[model samples]
Target: MADIQDFKSTPKYETFSYLPPMTPEKIRRQIAYLVSQGWNPGIEHVEPARASAYYWYMWKLPMFGEQSVDVIIAELEACHRAHPGNHVRLIGYDNYSQSQGTSFVVFRGK
Candidate 1:
């Protein structure tokens, strides 16, 4: 017989959910890739409890045509500072495909 009490259901978010939390270096690498691909970068955040919700609050307008990885990192850090208790994610918008190309959590909140 199986014990229901022993079963744990962990919620998985977007990309990289199965892996460990990303470090600052990993995040920078990802942002660099996005920039290299000519994809627009955007920041979104939500409370951990509401991570499963359909939509997260966008930090600001997407950085369309932005090419500086440093600027993106700065914005990400700013978002983290404002919402230290929220889960922060970085998303890449592919202009060629007219859709989102990738998304992953950069910061996991309590």
Candidate 2:
């Protein structure tokens, strides 16, 4: 028999999701935290039925340094509208290391 561990599966990335989904207010708070940490925020999404579903496409340019919280919220809304039946996520990039430092699935639309 093959090794059982080899048959097991794992997620491609570490992504956090809000159970019961997050309200707009909660999302704002989370974004606020990222901004306070001096991280850049960006959005990405993937179609549920697509092959290699784990792969995500960028929805907007990364916002770095201090930015208008409302703008982030607006972008989030636009992503939701554009991909009403897909999964959308938010990622925070640390400017210093130039890598993704935090991420979460902000929407799960079916």
Best by lDDT: 1
* The candidate that achieves the highest TM-score relative to the unseen native structure: 1
Candidate 1, residues 60-94: lDDT per residue as tens digits? 99999999999999998899999999989999999
Name the runs in model 1 displaced over 4 angstroms: 1-9
Error of 2 at 95 (Å): 1.3
- Quality of model 1 by C-alpha lDDT: 0.87
Give candidate 2's TM-score. Answer: 0.75
Each prediction's Cα lDDT score? 0.87, 0.73
| TM-score of each prediction | 0.87, 0.75
